[model samples]
Target: MAAGAPRVFVSHLSGVAVFDPNGDQVGRVRDLVAMLRVGQRPPRLLGLVVELSTRRRIFLPMTRVTGIESGQVITTGVLNVRRFEQRPTERLVFGELLDRRVTLTETGEEVSVLDLSVQHLPARRDWEIDRVFVRKGRTGSAFRRAKGETLTVEWSAVTGFSLEEQGQGAESLLATFEQLRPADLANVLHHLSPKRRAEVAAALDDDRLADVLEELPEDDQIEILGKLKEERAADVLEAMDPDDAADLLSELPEDDKERLLNLMQPSEAADVRRLMSYEEHTAGGLMTTEPIILRPDATVADALARVRSADLSPALAAQVYVCRPPDDTPTGKYLGTVHFQRLLRDPPYTLVSAIIDDDLQPLDPNATLQLIAGFFATYDMVAAPVVDETGSLLGAVTVDDVLDHMLPEDWRETEFHLDESDEADEDNEEVAAHDS
Candidate 1:
């Protein structure tokens, strides 16, 4: 089913007869399983908790379901007879999500989650609960059907939350600040009550949480990381920049740090482990393993293309490290740096090797924080390459990391305020001036 296809509300699927590709009745969809994601992104529809003829329930993954039309689910005849065991990440839609009281972002009026509409994402087997069918009245058991002020809105429109008090959801709180920068979001997380903070953090996707984790104070990082399931914690750490991930891990007890590292993908774990081996304030410790690395033969255009990635921080993108054969850090013999400006000035076909700034001295991995800061200050450079004794590029240290280390510990503790009134006033004044 396409994303644009009509969404089937979970209420309509209660006990919906599921059939095989040959049109034989397999079972009925007792409940839909969904895995909630971080932030306001929709929860993924994992599969159906189908009760077979033998009265044994099994999980039929969305991948196995080819179609859900005419009130019948068509499966690929590949059903896992194993009992449906809900993982820590899975939520049974009928059991947990429905009939919850949530609020509208616009009016802040509470509504009952009568049903959730799941949609098949375009060109993929994945499905997600994209809309919430709610009624502006009292709440009760899940899947309660009633008529009064009924309307279906995007999932975001509901007062999303899983609160210890009342029924406000974490997604509701996060939706209010969805556009915040990671640092700003970290500030919001920092000031929240511990329980609320963890809930909010848990709702964020791994990559986003990783970005926020990097900005948070060490204490906050530890607290939040501890609250997450180990598997998820490892995943979040893997998503973070290697240097940042290492720093967070180092704050944990040795046992915990090692456990998470082992759970991470081997390559990602290796990078974090290598970074942790360095002195906390040294170039090796501060340099990110995933810098823009290009070979000597790579064209200026190639270097430019790598630099333009939205994933890279501005400081990291400010230059490309030209190394020899092994492109992965610690890359083969370090050649020299090619600044972004240089890439722009040269023709696209020009070799990055021909315009190398070899005269610039690269920092040793063991270079001190003060030394790294001095190097950046002296050259007016946003980033610098870190080379080892073997003339290999260990990684590149961006100025942001240098400043992060050099700044006072309390710098990140400053309270964040989103005051747009001044900007609004300025805009009004400018408008008035223009009108006059």
Candidate 2:
């Protein structure tokens, strides 16, 4: 495992003794069950489980798990043992409420909780209860501790969470993209403050960061590029499509842009400069350099062999582009694409061109965005080839790029907006959407 990454399954819940705030041994933990948070799926803890005597199970919010030790489980507060004797209501365990959506009474508005605030109590510490709190969402809300309200119950009431929504002065931004579409992610980024935008950009893995960057508007892209460290910015630029990289570089001041270009690999720098040489908003300027090219005379077996040998980009699909002789056109004359699955289904000796779709639509180097959009809509293509006037293929434009242009400037705010009344409606909508 890499440094700072936790070792999975090294410690299990079985055989660990449970203790309350009073330091009384309640029972041994038999198992640990955790659910993903409201907006975070397959990541982020939601809740945990503790097994007690009499074969009863106790459910605890993730906030309640104060600490995990070699042989002990410490909770935030004391709980009545009787609470574990009965099964929890289905609503508490398997409904929208558990997802972190709740109604705020003050404005009759709904707010989706990112996480619950809980007090942590550790044994042998200087103070009885740890001042540092564990929370899923933004912490330090003065209204979190209203008089006479049970913290545990209030924490448990959470159901869903808002991303870019809650008018928090744009300080909160959704940075992760585990389950978000590129459009949704673009929306979330649009609402974040400059600092929060940097935080979000820093949190994303390279591929996702590249995806979101490719989707951002030119102005927003410039702002984000300015905030990132030189090294980090270089890394993101290296991971982006060549045309996108060139476009972003073109937006930078001459000095910074030249410095970044110097930092890139010679091949990458050359590709970006070539793309940038074209007029902005044209097909040649917008196309990606990493096209799946193969020899037209090659057999399916030979093509497959090349595919296996080459280091293909992870973002590419299963289709490979077959081109004419390099001597005829340095960039290789435009041919057609062949789907890997189709090639696999055919005889190995079959010629690549025989199996490829020769009638595939191609884009001219100077095609406008409106023309590109119309072509994409008409052909339903994930990508389209861009060829020079001499019929030599240069690059291709992907659907993801087109989708980036379709999102509105205020899209990010839509994700974070949460009102009390919308909580129930939004939860239902999310559930229905997920189910479908």
Candidate 3:
């Protein structure tokens, strides 16, 4: 540790927004870069690996950093703007140091590194590890009743162990990512090499992995899905939003797609199948089959309960569909929807049908993308129900899905966006979360 040098924990640096001199966010710090040194010297801070709005990873040298405060990293406005590529001698602090196993000098008790604090060198253009935050616990200790206490010690007091020989390569990295939001985790996964991405993906649970997969680009989606065993891949797909699952399946070979779908639970598979049957540009294809649905007789309390379920997506939870019988698809008959706001304004025991939005016309499953777009614009709705020819409720097409479909292909891979609709959808999710 150097006197008069600014310090920040590596964990705090992860996902911190990087702003230019004008206070405009240029990107987010995905990882910190450092060059491993000889002897007992700590690795020298090289720069930061930042991911831009376009999802490109670029390097920003530490020398360019002018300030670090208030959850943001300020830069000198001067940037390389070049893609980041790890050199042979460099190591990522978050990717390699955090969650790694190390031995405490005093007790000789092994601990897993939880975080690292780095300090800028005084009167120099460099930074070095100052402290190591380590947790005293064995593998899978998180599930145990008694948790380990984390300790912060000088970096020299701990010795790093090799994860590869411990039969847990990248497991530590994946564990750290478990705390990040799905979108942030997806960004981290996207920056990794193909092999590393697959390893981390394999380590995540089906639901978490599915969330990250939905955030990833279509090509990356297929690549990671292909790496999983058929059964696990099916589970991940089943956990994803039906529309997203269908879109991914649509990109796969027919035989492979069918095989994965068959491995899913029949109810889930049926929903995905119905979605896949629709043309890519149709409302059905853009809809999610898992919206909150209830019988017309269901109470406002019931609707509220459904909306509050953690499993439902924000768009799906925004409204409740009131149908006839057979609550699942075909949903018996297309009745009407009751917005969450309506539920909140009514008495708890009141029937949902009593306050349903009868004037809200449902989109036909065969409705074209343009027609669906017009329907959203006309109704000013965040989501709308899709019905079959017999007036059976199929699913609900969300505004976000429609926006994604309208974007040009390869939008995720390109720097120039067709529009900021995706970003707007992200904002909508945040607002919905707060409202809920």
Candidate 4:
């Protein structure tokens, strides 16, 4: 069937029906699902789930579904009913793949399949298999196997199907923000409009929201924060990196900022405030308060213990910073950073400094956005330390923050620009003076 063929409605179909490709009766369609809002048209058919024997179900993709005849449905592919009916260790074959990694040939990158697309096939009176699309990242660009791309065989691939389990998992979506590559997340966010960005953020839980927020640009952070309810906004901010939280707060109106800060827990609010106290363009302002700081004398085992207790960001670098006692020059007199990957192979009792990288590329407090962008491009650094003139650590600026300043014109609204033009016209008195 042509891709753009006009859609047809199935007649005499009171509800959904399910059948195998070989024309075996499976189950009946329960409902047609869609996203409908006020002023929006009724939800279109996306896909259907057939309730087979013993509560087993299969998703029929909308693309492969043709048309429905009287009491019969047509499908594009042939499926064995027994393969879908066998029970695997996991209750549902589809559910077992949730959160599992899959690679897409189009991008030659791996992504987690977030959600499966299902649609009703009226011709077969059954659901048909659709292309399996993977969630690319939080920004919502999905990775689909291009036409004719061979599916690579892996232990994770579904070979023989089973039907023992017949229900959905707690969270049926496969891919999540934490599982996405930072670069992919950035790409996705850059492409999303403010409204779409809000919808995506609203769909995520707090933790997932925090993960994506940390990877997004500052303007995006501000835009998304503006759209969320005060409580949800506060929750997401509280869960974000301290430096990121501070940057976002700085961009918000004073009243909104204060309100959100007040809504946060005492500890989280304090951390944000401390970060905010620094100048906006300074290193102190950019450094995250959540860094894994440890004593120079601490052993690998001790550092590992601290890591376990701390709520480390998922995108943490391979290194951990070694610090002196809490003092005015705590970060200025930094010992070094221990490479985390090395620690895994080294003795547990090894001193942290023994594995530290003293030549870390640190940021200066007065650095400009352009300069930061240069650093990000040159060093390919995910995170960099920011320090004051006194050599004291202020905060850290990350690649995501730098990218925020480089956003394309479409990312922000033009209302302010239009207002400026209006003001300039009003200020020009020559035309008015001539008229007078």
Off by over 4 Å in 4: 1-209, 212-233, 277-285, 305-315, 327-332, 373-380, 407-436
Cα lDDT of model 3 by residue, 1-436, tens digit: 2358467888777778999999999999888877756655777787888888777777787777888888899987765554577776667777666656778878899887767888888877577777888778764432232257877898778765323323234545765566788987887887776866786788788888999999899889999999999999999998998889999999999899889988999989998898888898898888888778899889999889878888877878899888898888778887798988888899999998889887877888889999998988988788999988888898889988988888888665556542545343333332222222
Each model's TM-score, in the order given?
0.61, 0.50, 0.80, 0.48
RMSD of each: 19.2, 16.6, 7.7, 19.3
- Cα misplacement distance, residue 398 of candidate 3 (Å): 0.8
List, residue by residue over 198-286, the lDDT tens digit for candidate 2.
65566566667787887776777888888778877888898887877987899889999989988888878888888888787777777
Whole-model lDDT per candidate: 0.79, 0.56, 0.79, 0.53
For 1-436, candidate 1 gives per-residue lDDT tens digits of 6467888877777667899988899888767878877877888887788867655566777777788888899987755565556676667676557545778988989786666888888877678889997878664322223446989899777656443344433543444456668975786577555866776787788999999999999999999999999999999999999999998888889999889999999999999999999999999999998989999899998998998899999999898988888899888989898889989999999999999999998999999998888888898989888989999998889988888888888778642332455223333332222122
Candidate 2's displacement at residue 298, Å, is: 3.8
Ranked candidates, highest TM-score first: 3, 1, 2, 4
Clashing pairs in 1: 38-203, 38-204, 38-205, 39-203, 103-159, 160-169, 161-168, 161-169, 161-170, 162-169
**C-alpha lDDT of residue 326 in model 3:** 85
- Global local distance difference test of model 4: 0.53
Highest TM-score scorer = 3
User: Counting only residues 3 or more apart in sequence or on different chains, how many pairs clash (N, Cα, C under 3 Å) in candidate 2?
Assistant: 17
Candidate order, lDDT descending: 1, 3, 2, 4
